[model samples]
Target chain A: MSAAGAGPGSREGHREPRRAVDGALRADTADTADTADTADTADNPGLAARVTTRRGGFTLDVAVEVAHGEVVAVLGPNGSGKSTLLGTLAGLFDPESATVTLADRVLTDTDAGITVPVHRRRVGLLSQQALLFPHLTAHENVAFGPRCAGQGRRAAGAVADRWLAEMGVAELADRRPSELSGGQAQRVAIARALAVEPDLLLLDEPFAALDVDAAPAVRAVLRRVVRDSVVGGQTVLLVTHDVLDAVVLADRLVVLADGEVVEQGPTAEVLARPRSGFAARIAGLDLVTGTACAGGLHTLDGTLVSGAASEPLDHGDPAVAVFAPRSVAVHRERPAGSPRNVVPVRLAAMEPQGEVVRLRAGASGRGPAWGEGLAADVTPAAVAELGVEPGDELWFAVKATEVAVHPSGR
Target chain B: MTRAAPSSPRTRSSRTGSTGHTLPWPVWVPAVVGFGLIAVPVAGLVLRADWPNFLTLITSDAALDALRLSLQTGLTSTALCLLFGTPLALVLARSDLPGLPVWRSIVLLPLVLPPVVGGLTLLFLLGRTGPVGQLLDAWFGVTVPFSTVAVVIAQTFVAMPFLVVSLEGALRTAGDRYEAVAATLGASPMTALRRVTIPVVLPGLVSGAVLAFARALGEFGATVAFAGSLQGTTRTLPLLIYLDSQDDLDSAVALSLLLVVVAVVVIVATRTRDASGVR
Candidate 1:
């Protein structure tokens, strides 16, 4: 994704790009280095599950695959069957007709009626709520899985101690859930999940409920854990609503809308060329639907906006042009440059975006009027030099190469 | 943090004085009557208790026999309630068995039924010449009436509802959240029940047991109706108090005070137990 305008805390605001790069690097290493030895298919090391479940009025039908050591993000809007997919993989619900194979081990085969129980599935699900056993101390909570798997008390305690240290919550071992902070509880939950040595780990918005100040620390721990597990053959599936989460942790993106997989590709590739409004919105890009022509597109606003497409499009084909706010140049007057397209618009609002300023320009020089608009992210210094304000008339320019045009889907 | 909503300063200042403004008589008067109705009788019972010779009267052979029998039967009755009531509570609270509402109503029958009526129902099932009782007598040579075991059974008949209802409410409130999580953590259903579910609802179970024991200790009508009053066998503390009222007023008051003290102890012990285990 195009980087978000760096906020006042510029380093933290730019966390997504830096993390996505690291994840991509690790993913590339894992893919090329170890594509052998599954005792079945040396080429395929990923776990695949084709889930189809009907609950209430929503029918969830999606196929998900995560390569060994690869982290895939199941990003979706609310009520998009994210939980249903995770629950079915974790063996909480039996899918109608599906096959779930994790590292060559079939966990669920509906046609064969071979559905392993939750405890036997060897799938670890850490939810938004920590769901720690309240009566158990952090250490005991971590030890529960090993103990249930027939370990002695001392052996289980040792296993718990090791994971607790690994999770960076070693000091919180004796503390109860109520005595622990939200982030601390979540870390312990992560340790608990790992102690089970699950083949497929489902992290369901583990940071969603955490405090803003604590999310970074938890995110760091999670990244380290996922990075370290590359050699251990553990596949991770992260379910999140936040694009930053997907951008930072997942190497691949699987976008779900209304219980269907709308898009799936490499994280950066899919993010840079979103086909849906939800995807574009999360990526923080302005999505303009236009009629594709030879060179660029003709927008519905009765204007010509020139942009490049990754692939050539046939004339009159419905397409979308996605561009970042930072790509737009805000000016007091029309400037002569190499810019391919320029639109005259009135400033609807100017919002402070960290070190940068984002100007919302619309057709009317009034507060948030109804019309086609462009979101322009410019430097605070530039805004001050131009003295931009609400209801100001201005012209914004964007190079054709900055906008990526792609075929729009129903 | 509450958002500071804009409001008139005068209105806020007036609201500060509203707490000082007494409640309307209609509301206050009925509330006082509700409190007084329950408090007045217990207060009178305490005030009328025989202070002098209370210890001496309770220590007498007849009173001692009844007190010992009541304690023994009450303990056994509460033990039985816990043994049976726990599973019943689990089934009622956790399962989705058909006819659940009807079964729940049937289970609550003893709670509202008169003690004498409950005793009669038990008699129909277990009394001599009764179907089950006849089978027991012919096969095992067991006669229930006028026996200490009968006293325990009668007390259980009258008091088991209190235990079951309390436990069911506890189990329902606790829910199966811990159990579900524990299963996902690799604990089998039975192991989860013992390790997670039981510990989570321990306070409820304790309170229920205490209430059942208290009810059993004071039971009189059911014991008299079903078990029959035989001194040192079925004559519990309440029966002793009823018997003493005819000849020894002082002993009757002393026995009543003892029952009240024991019930208070049970309540306080359970309260402390709950306070100590705050799950």
Candidate 2:
């Protein structure tokens, strides 16, 4: 444990010291106040990064911050520059322009011509693959970081054992990555990354490869480690597509779409009131962007969507109408009903969700479609009763009270 | 002892007397001819070998010396290949150096060049009258041509390309993701290569070394052209066999059989090791 503290980046040691108090998952700390270069840790207290890069047709420009001891999850769809952001932060991907400051260190500043090497950045990355050295056992894999930092063989082994115990994989210390299951290997990989005692831990879809049965256990392990990291004042940045990952692990959410930050807020707030199409889709909410009018909101196509304002908004201000799919009812024809908001739509797609079938309607399918992203949820029995298939001309009826309008946060 | 029949009797019955491996009828003709083109020469040598005197002919002093020198020089050249070629392979596969394609083409020259041309190139570089040879002569009164060291150099010149090409392909296939992961784990580039890259590609290195050793052992034109056939001094098994054929054909045939045995053993051993080493 003491040897683990002897990292090339002593700053990393200060961030996460090896602890062994509990049987295998000890919660202990080393008191080392040699914070000479870390004077700004209290002022900025976390990570501030602005990265921009262009490769071929794709361009990524993003700025994000994480408070000290906070976990910020970067949520994005595939090819949305999540990997680029993490790569630039970890110093693996060179950026055309970037200013990255973690705690007290300026890791990268293109204007200053300063780019910290990947190994010296003290930014540990746990990618989708565990990527443990195939030749090394779990114990040796964990010891590698300490050994690279100039610790003696015995000292590195001691550090490895302590970290392995902390990760609750002490019993698997002798097994190679090939012998370990996905969950076990990921656990060992976590220990290997933490053995370096990095200042920032970046998790890139750490549970994407695990099975449903194995993911929850790994998520629990990560939750415990993230909590420990918070106690040690270490910052964590998670990149994931799963809303559950953001809900369970992150303090803040930064949603990216098309290589830009489309929305970001507190995790709970963003989940409840997502502004971006990607965010709303993951949150299972239907969002239509328009301008607030006297009656409700007017879409760019001049279709009126009547709804109650969830927040105060001025007339002509950009607003969004949000409603759950379950709140919308599908009808074969315009019926004289209490629902005031009814629009003609063509069924575009259908997908089964646990107990209900979700039917989506788009503008391309049929007659005078009002909106493209309208959806409704109905039970299988209701679907059979309707006898609908894709391309069917349908009317989507929603009560004005069902839609909630709020400022678009544009 | 009674045994249970295979559960899928219909499938087993259909597979009777057939191993489930078949190629089109046209392929067997050229396949057999191509294999015979390689196998017939060794069959001829084995058939023509003086069986009663084969042991004594190969165990002769000059034959034994040539065998020893060939083994020694082949091993030394293989060692040299591994030492110098591994880094060259890494650079060719991983480095962003300008004109790397041209450099890789130059490194692969030995693979396609005639062994005589390779020998002549080495001679021009390291011969006594050559640039580097003149320096060695002036500085240390050393003569490289017609020496055992010259045999090793010629063999290494012709054999190293195999090692480098094999290893570079392995490096390319393995990719750098693991090294990047190691770097993030605080491993320096050199450390990552030593601990991660090298271990991951150990099978490639072993197979490459074996290929180089076999090529060095069989090197004929290069060793003869550069290092003259001086018995017990520079002549290797190939040179000895050539010289033996000028007089005693039995000795030459026996030695050829020895090389065939060595080459077969090396190739078979490498194939099995490769099969097991690769996950």
Candidate 3:
């Protein structure tokens, strides 16, 4: 909303003022523009949402806040209440507590004793499957939303055409969904959702089913359309398993595990420092638990290693050291290196992992106290140059800065 | 795509014998037996049909009245069934309503119930002295029993469930995902039903409607029991056939052939409509 931080790729850490300015400016501009057209109605801001469900000994409780022009990604592992959150938000799953609000409008507030019917809520939802009406052509499908909004046939058709054109799918307007490619159908679904001009937009893994190549293109188009919504403020919520997608489009990442928010923060920060093992896995990191001391960090398995001290260390305080696989430098012998933390370890195994070869190494004298063997991901070229092999004694250098140490509670 | 090369007579015979190993007797044998069983009724209808007197039999006043009434009531019942049943099917198949299993079972009850039972039930509920019937008679002073309306009601009571059950299955299989997509586009539930749900399940709905209509036209036990076999009133073609069979078998056979022909024509027309609708 504020223009202060509009500069591209400015990495000023903790730019709260700039972010606040931008957010305020954007919100103000949208507010003024919407009021000019829609008469500044109190019901305009829509509602905020929350859902809690318990079934078969599993509890799903997700609380989500959606702002206009912003896309909130609900990220979690499978069975982590992502879809449940989306469904609850969409008014499909009735929650015991309810408490879903939009703008100032109460969608489902148990305390207030209100539960709006789904059809009357004016919220639009897109699922993994586009679910376009198979019997209708693209144009007809687009027109369907406006028609449902009580527009006349001709008016709805015109609106549908405008949306179809906006989606860049006008050329295929006469084609049915069965005749469409996966990406095209999703685009049409988006266009249909837009045509209705819903107060809230709910997407449940809209791109999860798409091929990798198709997902990015569809996501780009979706982001563009969502950015240009006519509603003074449109709330967008996405539930997805793809972490990269959350990082790419979401303003905030809400990580759910076992139906609870394990971690949540700005997209970049959350990706950088995931708070839980599930969050770390989602962010593509391996989490290991250990302890720290003045000499070095000691593993529960009794393996001691020289590493950066996260805190002013006491004799034996519990801690965790997280290092990227790429950060661990493997050497055939004790090689001279600029890196400070070096440990003698035996290569446990080697396996090809995508573009790199991942090496698993264990310290000789008792393994890391509580953690498993440390893993190092290196390129095939690095593996070949180092002559790294199983059973070989090697010196691995882990830079102090690369090692992210945190106090361990467990 | 290429055709198999022609084999020598002995080789073909040997190939045929060997093919038996791959194909089981239960599959082809039952198919053959079913076809033969179906052919028997057709062969009887054709062989026994007096073509020269067919026109006379059909043109008879009683037969003509019965045929007209059958077509009229059957069509009316089918139309009512579609109007009410399709949406009911959509609700049963799509909504997450509590007690859905119970509602589904209720909708399908008529399908398995004997038509005579359905007619009797309708008679009890809609008869002149019945609860609803008493109110209708008190307000409108209209008696429905032994009338064309009674025949239509009897047929609808027996036949509507067939359309609803088939269409419900189709709706369930097709899913409500498309309806959700439509809703996101600002379509109300009703609009979504009319524009998306109806068209998506058209093939199933049409086929089911036709089947119901055919069933309605041939309904006899129910019509006779509830609406009564009154001449030029509730005497549908099936009722007439049943009545005529008591006096003349040839006339009954002629009426049966006519009904069969009509069913075949309706089926062909429906298939044609379905094929074009898909495209």
Top lDDT model: 2
Among all windows of ten consecutive residues in candidate 3 chain B, which has the lowest summed lDDT? B1-10
lDDT of 2 by residue, B32-70 (tens): 999999989878888899999989988999989998999
Classified by CAPRI criteria, candidate 3 counts as: acceptable
The deviation in Å at residue A101 for candidate 2 is 1.4
Number of the top DockQ candidate: 3
Residue B174 in model 2: shift from native, Å? 1.0
What ranges in model 3 sit over 4 Å off? A1-48, A120-122, A152-155, A227-235, A285-410, B1-25, B87-91, B94-107, B118-143
Model 2 compared with the native: what TM-score? Answer: 0.73
User: Evaluated with TM-score, which candidate comes out highest?
Assistant: 1
Steric collisions counted per model: 2, 0, 26
Instruction: List clashing residue pairs in candidate 2.
Output: none
lDDT of 2: 0.79
**CAPRI accuracy category, model 2:** incorrect
TM per candidate, chain B: 0.87, 0.89, 0.87
Q: What DockQ does each prediction reach against the true complex?
A: 0.21, 0.22, 0.25
> Given candidate 1, what's the lDDT at residue A96?
82
Candidate 1 on A201-299: residue-level lDDT in tens?
899998998888888678767766775552254568899997656655676678887777776655644564455656755667655656787777767
lDDT of 3 by residue, B1-279 (tens): 111111112333453475545676679999999999998989888899888999999889998899899999999999999889887887888778999999888888877888778888878887988998888899999887788888988888888888987898778777766666665565577777777777777788888898899889888878887889888899988888888899988899999898888889998888788766564
Model 1 lDDT vs. the true structure? 0.75
